[model samples]
Target: MSSAAPQAPDAAPDQDVRRIDDRSPWWGRLRAAVGRSRADLAVVLLFLAAAGWLTHGLWPDPGSRTMALNPADQVLYEWFLAVDARALLGDFGLLTDRLNAPDGVNLMANTTVIALGVLLAPVTLTLGAPVTFALLAGANLAGTAVAWYLLFTRPLGARRLAAGLGAALCGFGPGMVSQTNSHLHMTAQWLVPVIVWLVVRMLRAADPGRGGPDRLRLLSSAVGLAAAVSAQVFVGEEVLFLTFVTLLVMAVTYAVVDRDLARRALPAFTGGMVVAAGLALLVVGWPLWFQFLGPQGVATGLFSPHYFSADLRSWWTLSPLSVVGGDDAARLTTGPAEYNTFLGWPLLLVTVGCALWLGRRPLVVACLVSALAMGALSLGPRLVVDGQHTGVPGPFALLADVPVVDGALPMRFALVVLPLAATLVVLAVDRASASTGRARRLVPAVVGAALLPLFPAPLPTSGRPPVPEFITGGYWRQCVPPGGVLVPVPPATPRDPWPMRWATATDVAFGMPEGFFIGPHGRNGAATIGTSKQPTSALLAEVATWGLRPAVGEEQRRQAERDADFWDASCVALTVDTPYADSLRGTLEDLYGPSTRIADAWIWRV
Candidate 1:
């Protein structure tokens, strides 16, 4: 009877308990992990879809469609990709003569982006540069958003919804969208967050009370930071320079705001930064040398600081890329691709209000200080409001003459404000959500109102001029030898880059005497685009532009022959449908003696 009772009561209960407990530890933990992964996956997919929507203008037909506002920059990037693709196939050189012919161009001196090109060489060589460019543009936007989202959620402890919102602002904000119009160097910022995270880790490791300074952690973080910085240099040195400025401002602000924490963190922070700088030098030193002092290098700055400076009114204006207040704000910006800070007045007002509300947080204070400092610097030497010069000098004037700083477009300083603004918004929302009724509701409502007007619109695009049949159909092989020049009717100058498109279309099969690229001009090596003008090219350009055939004489014909010999010309080809084709053809016929109508071009064998 006792055995029967024990079996009935304990046996069934023990079996049930074992079954439940055995599954709970492993199965429950696995379920939680899968749920977390699924949430992360959902966020990534959402960001990617948003990126696609933002870049919808280019994906339909990248070969034909071009950024309507900045076709020049788009065409320039395509040429860069083509050069990089060719460079990967054992034709690699920091200085390439493919564009400027025998004089050559210093690739390291320009934003050639060889690292990104090599990574995408397969796509570029297979589907062509146009497709690779479009793919990369979308990937940059999505990848940046995803990276920032991870930083906000995992390290900063922001809620998922708040993090998503903030990351969207960082990735698709007015400045980011404006630069995304073919400025791959600025938009490829996914690595920035990783570097920021590593720095934060170093700071934490420096705190003596937290198990007394972790040397190993500090060293690892420093090495990681160095790797990230070196990679960033290859991606975009301008952005990296701006990032350093922002970080310096933030560190100083933090030190002032929280003396105790700063004292604890500074020792490790400074040490880690020193280590990172040393390591980064080891990696990028040679490339830097090649960029600044190598053959064809320009000694002077490329752009004017004052002209490209952001207008003070631009701070309160809306970006033309935004959904609201777009049409009225065009006059406030330099160009469609340079709308760096059209952070409407409403958003600025809200940000200031939130900063005041979250005044106790040290990180919040640092972000506010950094943003304001960067904003002030973005106004350049003299402040301009609504296209009127205010005659008041800006903070940037103090550093304008400094070597590396001189090259920066002062307006781009506004880009540093974007991530800072995003961080402030996320911290505000996350904190407010933890508070009671009225405060939470008011904060969110105001933020939503401010952000709705700044939502991004699809970018504008137009059809690109098609490549000539002679180049695409491979008929140039019959007239021009493998390593010889094919002098286009008017040549490829900065004003008319159409022939650059033709040269790249052939995968750089033939060199050109003239092209749209920066080259050393004078004894001091001041930067100039395209080669020095020759008599033959000048005459041809004049004829093509005004449809007026010049008076052909023996002297002009002799100059043309000398130019052809100088260029090592194998043939001279003029597209049948080029503008003022008859005038150009007459001039070419007079110079070269006769022309053969082959394929879709008038070919004259030199």
Candidate 2:
């Protein structure tokens, strides 16, 4: 029949086949990669949904959603938005006059999260600060989970569902959930796995047993690692520091357990680290200098490590972020920033058991020591469970004097456990699914049960009163001249924080005398902010705190004038909703004569 052979029309006489190769233009390959990323878009969407669901109360009205446990976190977010506004105006001062007024704060010294602030600038500029905070918070959880998921599935060769389990456990587990209540800086852990992935790529390329990578591949990996570390510095330097400590410990553990593999991987890993550190220093050298050696910065931790060390009982306690957590969950925490450090009995047992059972495996051995070491440190300088403090000090006390490491909280070291736990759990789940006979049924059931109580509940939120109309509606702009200060009458305190609110609402158009920021406090260069208790400020703070109008004498009047002159404040305004607003206004009137009413506040032009 005619169909004995089907032959395609031969290439045209002059035509030649062109093979697909690296010859494709850079942008063309970039576009192709972008298209492939759409496959991961699902992971992003799923994570975003999960994060949003957990903190859903923040949505619908992002402006009003507040962090009840950590008011300082909200204050920091407002500062981030203010920074974004300044950046939009073409003013990129790393040291801001908006906070400490005449004196300023080195942004590098704080957890400013410069990269996140810049990246989310548009969202903050448009919807306002609180909304930007909520979005970032959600993104932090989701993005972190997705990053781990990609690493497990793409390079580590884990199954899809298994990878997802790993991702969820890392992203939304109790530790992460607790941090979500506040602490945007610590929550930004998405980059850790990315660094690991890049390091792995370099290690594979450098493996002598196989054909090692070319110079170009090694260089590329090195550069990539450098970029990731630099970005991580902006997100959370403490986390980055912890990452470094954890990696070193894990590497040592691996060397002890599997010397040959360590021998193969260590040189390449060390070379890559050198490259990354050198590049990071080059990019951020000046800022780092200011942070460590300049006027505002402190070389060591601002507080003693003992103050931030975790209580041992915190390991078994439930976090407020958990569905089963009670109202007292907040009481158990060291502060607003460390709530989710809880490691439930079941989850802890499974993770430790898996680490023990899978000891011979390279992945398990490396992760096991990382978790154990960090966990021990989280127990703090001395072991404290429930309420009693034990005389036995923990491992972290050794690092308390180690330069920058001293400044970081020991409790946060617990973050190392979640990812390791996730990896172990995923391996178990995947192995069970792939196994034969009775093994398959039992393992999955066990894995599911271990994670049951760890499931998160929606994050609790409170209402944040909106900024007054005087600043938001732009009336304050008319009052304060260029470079002049706008000092709120009650000044700034942790509770009310009016000056900070007004300054943020006005987009830092005017300087502020005091704000809710960390800055030089006493002779020690100790970190503190908000209104200092000067004679005049103390009088105002007293009335505000006690809701009582104290007698204002000529001394108080003279003191007010002196403060305004020193601050160079062009105008002094008072918000109606400020704590004991009326009383403070009455006291101000007694001191500064009759004040002009403007919008929802009283203003006095200096």
Candidate 3:
């Protein structure tokens, strides 16, 4: 034996000798950082590219192009963002007389995405609300995909390709694409994955085999969860509520599938929940209270559960929004924005097979059970297939009248199913990626086939009525004073919402009598789209609807004067090119005398 010890192996010749300098140029430092996160950057870029394609129509002319399927909602959200910008400049309040003037609108009671609006206030104030709306529409889709991708890759141990595919489905699936037609609230789901991740961490901490629950980690995660919950409340309470329900269902299913695991996780989960609940209350309890019980808050459901429910066949039918397999299956859904259950037959079959094949895994079992439960609830109180009622009661009937639950459209339950389906896909793809030979090629091919037909087409858009130069050219500021009303000739209402666009265009320089908003309409604060009709507004609505000029008399003039005074009217303007303009002009002339033609509209100084 050699007396001397073998010399230490020489340092590997190929070992890196370069060190990242702390004092390097900013661009160089940024480049190094980018190099470290190449995977994440690639995923984000891919999602952004997809979102850009989906929303390309709006970018061409955001002010002129509007979602054809739901322009009212697009206009409404534009107004909301404009109002948010105004609020930042000391116009702060949860209620405003900008819309539904005289009576005012309770913004807290509606689907007001205040957090999103505030975040985009700079864009809304500078570029205008239309630009802000377009940007947010695309961001929601891309941000959601990136958020879910992080969750899948970091926590679930999914391969980059697998996670990206799964996240793409969660973000740009048929249902999500349908919602992009102006359902901003429904599309804002980027925070959901953060909440889910915190939940997973809490449950994992409880396992004794995983070093038991770490008190400090649990407390920090609980606080993080609380913050996320509170922020989501401001974004969209409806989505937050659905997320809670989905989590509860997931918890129950998880417990049923693996008693031992659930029992072990119970301690940490319960502790985290208590802490998170208390902190969330501290942050969002007041806003939540105002939303449910403050001035003008609605006390009843705003939508009909039966009308908004998913059709049974919608699960297998392709959405009209799908690029490859689209059909005129409009009867299966309420409208373009509510196509919440258009998972094609092939994807549904694949999901089922994956769930069954991975049944032994507790998490997979929980996802499958939870998805089925949500799917059942999405059928509403009664089953309908192929546009015909089956007369069979659905599981939702039992929960239809439940307080907070009643406010949610049953079809939105399918939104929860989307992520669950994506989870199954991620697991299946991950396993397939790790497999050798035939399984790898076969599995990816099958997934691609199942997912290809559901690829989203760009959202449809159409030209909106142009805002007349009379309003856009700063002429309205001459007729309407600061914080005063500028009543349109026929008065803005849910049906004729063009005038609302004028107010938003001017950054809400004036108020209007009626607008597109949900508020109290009758006793017990029952929800309706607009305020109760004033005599003058009702008369105008009648003329606008029928295009007939009614006989104007002293009594009609007196009523118009009273309404004008009630609204503190400063000006009345009518777009000259509108339908029934002659009738509106005649009625207004009869009531307030001759009007002055200016730019593209007739104006009367009230």
Candidate 4:
């Protein structure tokens, strides 16, 4: 059992009550939010330092730089720019024709990072999206860690040192670093703690034996929880979904293990959850409707569950994200930055060992069971052992066909298990390190040896070329009217949203033909992205792809005019020396006469 005294559910820990942040009024909470404490400031500094080191390529300047080979990062940059444009324009619609042109896309279905977009609007406006991206990338990991640290210390009854250990594991662990590859939604998990904290408080207040829930107080707490969940929907619906699954698993397991306590908790738990869900639905109903039923919405089952499921050996391996590992160690499980659960043998053993050792403790049991359940679900229907698919089905079979849940990647279920492992490991480390016996002296050495192999490397980044003078120096602005379409020669594809670099840097004053984003593919609303090819554009794309020019005849000429009109193209700009640039220029010249010289390119007004 945990070496802590149990208290009434409604009672605050004496230590927590002593803290001014908890006891003081709104001003004190505001101070805490602003991170007034020395420890909090230290965490911020640490995070800033980490961000600087990780995104060094984007340092000292961003408008003139980019991160190469990170399509996800690139997509997020567009989102920042898009959100900024929409907010400033007073547009409430999440759908846009800026990319995927005529088809447009429902931004709600994409990783729009709405919460981050709104929260960091000031920074984005002043500094640009790349800097915002870089800062948020680092802050997400650090902030999540700090949030977990606070929760562990205050509510979970862990020591400050123990909380730090857990926070470090939760913040910069392999799972988090892997997500930093490009997934902002998964990375920006700071609100998860806030939601969890609120839920715990509500649950405590709901305990009937502790004078029961005061109707007004319980309703208010329910509202708070609802707001948190609603906020999460805009932030990361997948993470929100995963949170629900994690809590449900924990609750179910707890009920199974402790029947009497389960009975006592059942009514309050259900009521609180019901109220929270209802209120959350009210807040997100319209967006949810647009996401599912509006134009460009996609169907479930974006990818095969089994294909994306975890390899059994992945849990015991290391990834390139690990500081101590080489390419060989990294290759043992999947490619770089995709290792969802490369827990490594040492950490896995330590986590399981701790869970077994602490099985008697209710809190420990809950954490362990939740982690194990998520791990099982991550493995998908078919077991893959050492990259070989075994014919056996797995635990995820139960959820494989379930609506929005089915849209989630089975492998990403490991995210829910991540914090549980961190919590368990920290608890074990705290008990061992804080002991008075001789074991205390050896604890550091043993723990270091086990954890050293899993230490995360600084995030890997690459340099990209800066925005072209055409856009930055305002040449494109001269050619295209505000909000007019400036179709690039080789527009943009779903896979290569390269033009977005210019689009975003130009502050999204104009739209492009097609850019990187997901939208409806066919009559059935299949999820697809990238450019849809028509005749003239198709010919141009083929030329870009193969360096071969097709015959541009009368039909193609008419098609080109139609395409330009369709895109509402104010000017057709061709960047010199881009793939098949010569052919594209010749074709456009045939259709619309010689192009006028522009900065770094030629433009023909539509």
Candidate 5:
């Protein structure tokens, strides 16, 4: 009977098939929860608010009564105003024009980070210049947050307290705070770490086992590398150094981990190089090629050292703590390093120890190698003899010889080192935390303790002099009253022994009649002098130069004259503790008749 019923062909044995899906809704929820916790949303929010308040409070209102109080802020204000003008005219072409403009290229020529302000063009249109500057400041803050997350989360392995401290260290780092007013480009330097993290992610994805490294991933890495390099070029050398160090670290790490992985990394590495080359061609290569390629190229002397020596001591002590307590205390005592310095020196020591302990870990080993490489680069031999023999300069000399970077004085590449330092500090803290229990608690406690002395105190407002009114008026006055032009006059300085300053003033004055001066003493003023032989005419030479359609305005000539007078009078009139101001006073009297003072600024008629 059992055979007849046929047992339904043995009825398969009721195999209770249970399907399990690896992906679950709770998985996403879990990830989100973890990310939120690691980030410390509340603390981040608080820091953001504080940053916003400080930015808003310190920023001068466009056309308001407040004047630019510091050299750094002054430069940013002028640069913003210039950008605002170009934006108002809807002249995207000015991208080129501004780049070539005497002041535009002069201030930003060597340092490309000034271009980051271009992102503010839309913001400027929507909210006005004040808001744009505010946004710019906010972007710096956002960059810090991104940098913190990037440094602490993955490579440092996300510990909330360590991450928070690392972020705070970056936000309040000495170089960051010291140049807060002047180093807008350095502020943009924060982007480098983010880019590094992206590259690392792409590299990790391409780790051979994961589908053997996709071409797309390689392409993306290349694109990202190009973008990072381009951004550094825009920001100038400091950021450039950071980018270089970061890439070098990654490259070395890849090399050490697995020779095969290093080989595989070639495509991505080359792709990045190609991208960077393309961008360089677009920005400086084409123009330089055209300008210097022919017979005239030799005359330009692109290889010449057009600037003076920068102080080495200043670069090393850019931090407030270093300035105050380090050996070079006397030289750095004057700046505002009071509030924004890192307090975790002992923690930093512990971090170093932990890093040494974790030296075998791939990421840590890579970072350590990177740090050593960067240090060697920054502090390596000059190789003057080698440079002369080779005709081609070494990388360090070439970097120092670059225009904007050359003018950075002692801190020529400090922008580059700051991130490395920050990363080391973060990594160190992370390592300590990961070690045995005692070390973890000790690291944070030591850091907190060191930071105690530098805790921010209420900055005094009473002694804070009112920012000049003209600086306010020129920056704010939306429309350059039809006939008026903004003319920038170079401020008189002991370093500027020649009448070259006058030429710069004349060049800026030649453009528009609104009579708004932006020069050495005005907005966008800096320590270096413009050296372009045809500074005044450069903007008119090429449509691509100012990113504007080529057109001439009749009013431009008359405006130039008015601007010249303003430059001759105001900038020259503002005397200093230097002899150059006295020479400028005499030069102004010869060029334009004696003029009465307008607020703190003097007005002269040619």
Candidate 6:
């Protein structure tokens, strides 16, 4: 019995035992080497090369009017330019003043564009607007690429081919392609899918069983969600829909899968949202808060079902494929093409198929519910009248009337549903592919083919007619020139939509003269104004009255005269449709004699 039967040779310690090198075999390595990353890189490079060629061929010739600025873009560009110029010169007060001015407040509401402007400030300051635009655009493209990579990596199991295809789909997708020249806000909007994917991953990681410093994971998730939310807020109400859909998906998923987890997730989610909300507030929150809280806020009238409805036919017939360009005056009916662009229909079909097929998986179910909820909103009144509203019935009617939701362009809610739909389609195809060999090979191909038409089409170089430049007139021309001053103008009529409504008045009066602008309304600009209660006598006097006529009367003219004298405004620019334009023009001419027309609305010192 010699002691303990000579204990068997101590098993090799886990640390000492070498684990099987799970490294891919040489053939597998070779296949991977030639696959995914390499292929994706090649595709990306090809697209870039094509873009480069197009840029070169279509590059705006020096002095070419074709490159003349888009009015909306010009307003933003100049505003940022002014701020960056002031910030660089150490005139923080001046910069702040110009930013907070009524006009500045309006533009600031466009958080997406404003954020881009903020990011681009340094570049614009250093490299100038052209280069800044180029840099941001390139970055947006890169972002799309990265987002695609992330999307394909985890849920799709690092399937390089599929990832590459997805990335290509995003790059060439109708949404991305159409928005190429629009700048950061729309570009960021196009990245919503990636944002959704990242949020999903973080949520998955946050699963308690998958524990590793969950607080850290929660923080990371919040940051991503917040960033996505912030980006949406900046872009417009359209993106808000996307953010809502994403949050709803996460919320519902957690609720159905594990109510306890959902409960736990809420605080973390809220915390993340707060972070984003706080950031938004810091950037442009003050004015938004004021709008909701102040006198104008109540008068603005939020939440109307009619507000959400749009002529759906425009979605299909107005895109590049349709002969109709954006005829703002034209009215059209709802059609399949309007809402679902090139890839839209195919994606929808696939999504429906996937929902039906993978109805069992919790993730799939969660995605389905989220998509249907958003889709119902997108359908607007149709869902209710058709009796389909029973599925998601809520006081959507009540919710629709909620101030925040109602105050915005309600039709834009479709954007919120998009990512969920995309995820569902991807998941369905993913599941189908995983089930069998034929499906695996065929699924991605079908997805790819379906998305192909959405890619940018080659345009004929010779006949590419020159786009006409719009003559800048009115308020835009006046305030943008050197030595301009805010000319008090009347509050916009409700019928005037967007920049035309509020931004036009503010940009001319405040932004033009001050050398900074925000948007079409004082909403965003007022936020930038922060808590500084200092009144803009000129602005207050004019906007105190709602209609445009009185704002342009003798009182405004006398004030404009005084401002011209004080601010050394050599010219006056007035936005058309304002009663004050004619009065201001006559007063200026009578007082200062003659002025020259720079563009349409701009009047300059003779």
lDDT of each: 0.82, 0.73, 0.83, 0.72, 0.43, 0.43
TM per prediction:
0.93, 0.90, 0.93, 0.91, 0.62, 0.63
lDDT of 5 by residue, 211-277 (tens): 6456676666656666666656555445565566457665766476656666655565555556646
Ranking by lDDT: 3, 1, 2, 4, 6, 5
Clash counts for all predictions: 0, 1, 0, 2, 35, 32
What is the model-wide C-alpha lDDT for candidate 5? Answer: 0.43
User: What are the runs in model 4 whose C-alpha is more than 4 Å off?
Assistant: 1-36, 64-69, 72-76, 214-216, 329-335, 439-445
Q: Pick the candidate with the highest lDDT.
A: 3
lDDT of 2 at 134: 82
* Model 1 per-residue lDDT tens digits across residues 112-133: 7777887887788887788878
Give model 4's clash tally: 2
RMSD of each: 8.8, 8.4, 7.1, 4.0, 13.4, 10.8
Candidate 2: C-alpha lDDT: 0.73
Worst 10 residues of 5 by lDDT: 1-10
TM-score of 6: 0.63
Q: For model 4, what is the alpha-carbon lDDT of residue 356?
A: 76
Which ranges of candidate 2 are over 4 A from the true structure? 1-41, 327-330, 529-531
Native-to-model Cα distance after best TM-score fit, residue 472 in candidate 4, in Å:
1.1
2 versus 4: better TM-score goes to: 4
Give the 10-residue window scoring lowest on summed lDDT in candidate 6. 1-10
Expressed as tens digits, the lDDT of each residue in 80-118 for candidate 3 is 888878867888788888888788888788777889988
lDDT of 2 at 262: 61
